[model samples]
Target chain A: MSRDALQESLSAVMDNEADELELRRVLNAFDDAETRDTWSRYQVARAVMHKDLLIPRLDIAAAVSAALADEAVPAKAARGPWRSLGRLAVAASVTVAVLAGVRLYNQDEIAGAELAQQTQQPVMAGPQVKGPAVLAGYKESADTTGPMANGVLQGQSGWQDQRLPGYLRQHAQESALKGTESALPYARAASLENR
Target chain B: MRAIPLLTLLLSGWFALPAHADEAQDWLTRLGRAEQQQSFQGTFVYERNGSFSTHDIWHRVQDGQVRERLLQLDGSAQEVVRLDGRTQCVSGTLVAGLGNSRDAPSRALDPQKLNQFYELAVIGKSRVAGRNAVIVSITPRDQYRYGFELHLDRETALPLKSLLLNDQGQLLERFQFTRLNTSVVPDDRELQPSNDCTPIAVANSKAPEVQSTETWHMEWLPPGFQLTNTSARKDTQTKATVDSLMYEDGLARFSVFLEPISDASVTETRTQLGPTVAVSRRLNTVDGEMMVTVVGEIPIGTAERIALSVRGEKKPAAQP
Candidate 1:
C-alpha cells in the first residue's frame, strides 16, 4: 500500500459513507495511486461544502509524495501495517525497474578492461587512464596482417597461442554475420576490419 | 562396501550446494590460479568483432616457476615464450616496431582489488575444453565495469573457457578450448618463438614523454575513477604531437586521446562494439582545434559527457 491510498480511506471514514468492507479495502490499497487520487478529491469536495479553507486545496496525496521525495517530511507514519507497506513499495519499484529497462548504470564498464594495468597517474603525469583498459593496445594493432585483421590467433601461450584470439575473433565475427536483429554486432565486426 | 555408493552420492550433493550461486568469486579465483598451476596444452578459439583465430597454449608450472608457450596453428608461426610471467619474444606483425615497446611494467592479476568493482559469485556449471568444469562469475557492482564468467577445469583449477558479458547479459566475447591435455609437460622446443621473434632490449627503455599542461583534462568523471597513465607521442603523418591519458577505477579502464586538428571541420563521432563505446568530441583549446577521442567500455552517454568535459588546464581563462 502507498501513502495515498491510506489517506483516501481515512477521508472515507471521516465522511461516514464507507462500510466495514469498503474501509478494509481502502486501508488495504491506501498507498495505491487510484485510491490516493480519490481520497484527495473527496477531501477537496468536503472542504468546499463546509466552506472551510482551514486546509486549502486539500491535495493531501501530492503533499505526501513531495514530502517523501524531499525526505525532509516527517516520518510520522504509524508503526502498524505501514511498516510492511514501505517494504512492499521499495520491492515493487525495484521489480518494475528490473523488469523494465531502467537499469542503474553504476557498474557497466567496457568489457575486458581488467586486462589494462592500473597506474597511479598523478597530476604530475598528464591525464589519468580510467577503468580496465586490458586490450586497448591491440585495438591500435588491427592492421592487414594483425592477428585480428587475419582473423587468426597469435601468442606464445602454448594453448592460447593456438586458440585465445581465435575465440575472441570468432565471437565477434559470428555475432556480426549470424544476428539479424540489430546492427551493433555488424558494426563491431566492421570496426575489426578498420585496420 | 554395499552402502559406499549411496554415501558418495550424498557427499557430492552436499559439496555442490556451496558452489551454485556464489560463482563469480570462485571463477575469478580459478582464473587467478589457472595459468599458474594448470599443466595443460590444447587447441582453442577466440572471437571478437570481425575476426576469429585458433591457437594452442601449453602451460606448466614446476618448481614454483611457470613456463608457457602459444602458437597459432592456422596462420604464420605466431609464437611467444614466457619463462615466468613476462613476454620473452613475439613473432607477429603487431610487434614489428620493436624499437619502441611501451615501457609500462608487466601487469599481474590481483583478485583482491578486482572485487571492489565486481561482485564475485558462482553462477552455474559447464563443460569446456572437453573437461568437466565449474563456472565462476564476475559481475560489476556498478555501471563502471563489464562482467566475465569463467569456466575452470574442476580438477586442475585452470580456466577452460571465459565469457565477457555486458550489463544487459549480452555476450561480448568468448575464449574457450576445444581440447586439452593435462598429463604431459610441453617441451622447450615447442615454447620457442619463431624466426620473426626479436628480443627487446630491456636495459635501454624509456616511457613516452608527457606533453605540455595545455594538452587536456576532463572536468567530469564517474564517482571514483582517476587518471592513471599519460604519454605524448609525435604523430608521424602530421608531425604534430598527440597527448593521451588513461583512467581506471581499480577494475574499469578508459583512455582519452587528444590530437590537435589543423582545421575546424572535425565532426563528433560515436561507435560501439560489444560493451565498448567510443565517442569523439571537438573542443576549442587555446592552442587550436583539438579532438578529444574517448575510447573504452562504457555507455555512449557517459562517453559523450567525458568528451565534453575535456579542458586544457594551461588555456588562458576566457575573459568575461
Candidate 2:
C-alpha cells in the first residue's frame, strides 16, 4: 500500500473508526520501520492535541516485535508414535486428576457434615428454638461441599458458622422487603430458606 | 495525508458513543416503568453456584397498584407476597426481630443514577422465554460492583432474563423466565398468598428509644454508594444490640451489620455464596470490641474493605 493510504488507515485505527479492511491494512504495514515511525509521530501529535500525558519514546509494539523475534521456537521434529504416547500420557494424567478431585470433594463433604454436626449439638440442645438460624447454617454446610466452591468459608467453624447464616438471611430478607425489583431479591431470600 | 478526514471521523466516533448510550438508557427507563404499567405472570428459575430453584410468579397491576406473589416449585415451599413494593407476607422461615424498623422509602430503578456507577449499553438482541428480547449490559465502572446482563422483553420491556457477572466475567447468579404471559393479567385468585405464607407484622407505632442513640459510621464507602437504610435491633438469641446499615449504588446493594462481641472467640472471616459475599472484621471501639460484618451482592474484596472501614461514632459528652 502507498505510505499516504497506510498513514490514513493508521489514523483511522488510532481513532477506533477503522473498518476491518483499514485495520488489516494498518496491521499489515505495521512491521515497516517507516510505518512505525509515522504511527508514533501521529500518536505524539494526537497526545499533544488531547493534552494526554504520554511517554513519547515508549513503543510497545516495537518492543513486542523484538521479543517475538527473540523467542526460541520449539523443535517440531518429533512425530507419529511419540506424539500418540504423549497424548496417552496426558489422557492418563487427566483421568488420575479427575479421580483425585472426586475423592477430595467427597472428603470435603464429609468434613463439612461433621463440622456442621458438631455445631448443631449445642443449638439442638438449647431451649431457644431458633429454627431458621440452625436450618440456615445446616443448609449452607450441606450446599457447599467444596471448601472453595461458591467461596464458602470452609474450616473456620467457630463464630462464622453460628452467626454468618443469620446475617446472610437477615440481609437477604431485608433487601427483599425493601427492594423495588421484588422478584430477584425475593428469589434470593427464598433460596436462603431452602433446605 | 488524510488528517482532516481522520479528525472528522474521530470526532464522529466520539459523538456516536453517547447516542448508543442514550438508546440503552431509554430501554432501561422502559424496564423501570414496565412492572408498574404492564401486568405479567411467569415462571422463572433462580440459579447460583450450588443452588437452583424454580419459582412461579403472579404479578398484577390494577388501579396503579402492583401485587406480586411468588412460590417455589421444588424443595421447601418458599412464598412471598408484595403489594405496591411493600412486602406483605413470607412463608417458611422468617428471621426473628426482622421488619420491625421502618426503612427509607424504596427507590425505583433510576437509570440516571445507575449511569453514574455503571456503563449502560445495548449489546445485542436475543430470544428469551420464547419472546424477542433486547440485551442491555450494565457494566460496573469500578471494581467495587458486579456487572449485570439484562435480557428485557422486546414487546413489554419486562426483564425476561438477568445474569450477574463478577469482574472475571464469571456467572455468579442467574434469573431467567422460562415462561412469561404478558397479555394475560393474573386474576385475584392467582395473586392470593397461600395459607402457609404468614403475613409480616406492620411496623410498631412506638419507635425503639435506642434507634436515636446508637450510631455507627463508615470511614470510606465505594463511590456512588449511598446509605439507603439504618436500623438497630436486639438479637433474640445473643441479646446483643445489632446496628445494621444498608447501602446501594442504584443497581447493586450491600448491608453492614455491627454487633458488640464481648467474646474473644470470633475471628475475622470472609465467604462468598454465589453473588453474595459476607466479610466479618473485628473492630475495636471505645465501648468494647464490635464485630462488623458486611453482607451483600458485592465483591469479596469490596466487602472486606467496607468491613474494615466500619467505625463506631464517638458519643458526645453529657450536656446536663
Candidate 3:
C-alpha cells in the first residue's frame, strides 16, 4: 500500500469508522516498524486533541507479544543445563505478566469499589431506620446476612429456580435415606418442600 | 488466716477447671449411651430463622433394643419410627425416596474423636424443660462445620436442648425439649406409627438394584468430611441418570448431585435455603455437559468450592 493511503486507513481504523477494506489494509501493514510508529504517533496526537491522560511509552500489545515470544523460544531449546535456565526465564516472564495483570486488576477494582460504595449506600441506610440498637447488636441486619437469607439467587427466573428445588429435595431426601441422624436430614428435606 | 484460705481457694480453682472439662466430656459419653439405656417421652421444639415446629418423641428401651418414634405436633403428621437406630417407617413427607440400604449404624459420640474437631467446655449450668441441665459447648476447631451448645439433663445425662451456632456465634437452629419424662417406659401402643406412616422397603443387602457407576469424584473436600453413600438412578422428570454422593463429617453433611445437562444452557448458580446452601456449576465432561450441584448444611463459600471441584472420569475416545 502507498504510504499516504496506509496513513489514511490507520486514521480511519483509530476512529473506529474504517470500512472493511481500510481495516484489512491497516491490519496487514501493522507489522511494519514504520507503520507501528506512525500508529503510535497518531494515537498520541488523538489523545492530546481529546485532552485525555495517556500512559507514555506503554504499548501493552507489544509487551504481551514480547513476553509470549520470549516464552516460546525456551520450549524449543535442546534439553541441557541451558534449557533449565531458559525455563527459568519463561517462569520469570510469566511472573511479571501475572504481576502486571494483578496490578491492573487492582486499579480496576479500586475504581469499582467507589461505585459499589454508592450502590451500598441505600442498604446501609435501611438498617438505620430500624433503630440504633439494631446497629449496636451483633445480629446482622435483614437482607444483609447470608446469600440464602437475602434470597440472592432465587428471584432469577430460569432453570436454576426450576431445577434447584428438585436438586435440593433430592439431596435432602437422599441424605436422610442413609444418614444416622434421621430427624435433622428429614427436617431439612421437609423444609425444602415447605417453600 | 486470710492468706491461707485464699491460697487454698486458688489451688482448688486451678484443679476444678480440668475436672469441669472432664465432666463435659463425660456428659457427651453418657449422651451416646443414654439412647440405648434410657426410656423417655418428650416434646421438643426445633426452630430456625424461618421455621418453627414442635415434635413429640417416644423412645423405649426394652430387651436391649431401642425403639423410638417421633411425631410432628402441628401441621403435617410427620412421624418416624426407628428400631435399633434403623428407620422402620416414616409418615407424611418422610416417605419420599427413602432407600432401605442399611447405612452403617450411627457412631456413638466419642469424646476423644469429637475433641479433635470441637473444643468441648462446660460453660455453666442452666434449667431446661424444668430439669437442671449442664451446658456443654462444642465449638468447632475449624470453620468447615458449625458449633453446638448442648444442654444435657444433669440427672439423666440426656440432651435436653441443643443449639447449632455458626462461626459468628449466631444461632442457626435450636432443638430444645419443652417437656421431658425419662421416668416411665413408653409401651408398644405409643411407639406404633400412625395410619399415615408408610413402611420403608428394606433393600436386599445382597444386591442393590441401582448401583452408581461412581464416574465422578471431588478433587477437594473440606477437612474431616467423608463420602458416606453413593447412588445412581434415572431422574423421574429429566429422564437423565443422576448420580449422587453424600458426605458427612459426623456433625455436618453435604450431598453432591451430578446430572447431565447437555441440551440445556443452564448457567452456574448458587442458592442458600435456610441453613442449607446449594451451589451449582456447569462442567463439561467427556460424555457431555453436566451440572454438578453441591447441597448441604455447610458454609456457602465451602459449598461453592465443593461445586467447582467435582471432576468427571476421563474416557479415551474409542474412534481414534
For residues B65-121, write the lDDT of model 2, one tens digit per residue.
999989999989898888998888888767765777565688889899988787788
Interface RMSD after interface superposition, model 1 = 18.4
Q: Write the per-residue lDDT of candidate 1 for residues B1-320, one digit (tens) a residue.
A: 32244345335433533344445555555566666676667887665544455777777678888777666665455565556755565444321122242444423345666765665556456677668987666766566567677677888767677666665554556566889898988777776667776444431133233344464667889765766556565543455565666666654556676777765544565655445556667778767787777766566667788888988866455335
For TM-score, candidate 1 versus 3, the one ahead is 3
Stretches off by above 4 angstroms in model 1 are A1-195, B1-23, B75-77, B95-107, B202-216, B223-226, B249-252, B315-320
* Number of the top lDDT candidate: 2
Structure candidate 3, residue pairs in collision: none
The parts of candidate 2 lying over 4 Å away from their true place are: A1-154, B1-18, B202-213, B316-320
Q: Rate residue B267 of model 3 by lDDT.
A: 78
Scored against the true structure, residue A2 in model 2 reaches a CA lDDT of 81
> Candidate 2, residues A1-195: lDDT per residue as tens digits?
687788889999999999999999988888888888988899779867864444324455654444333331211234778666655555554454455435434434433443343344345324224555323423423432334353344676867877888889989988888887648998888888764
Candidate 2 CAPRI grade: incorrect
Give TM-scores for every candidate, taking all chains together and pairing residue i with residue i: 0.57, 0.69, 0.65
Measured by TM-score, the strongest candidate is 2
Of 1 and 2, the candidate ahead on lDDT is 2
In candidate 3, which residue ranges exceed 4 Å CA deviation?
A: A1-154, A177-183, A193-195, B1-21, B94-97, B100-102, B202-208, B211-214, B314-320
Alpha-carbon error at B15 in model 2, in Å?
6.3
lDDT accuracy of residue A13 in candidate 3:
93
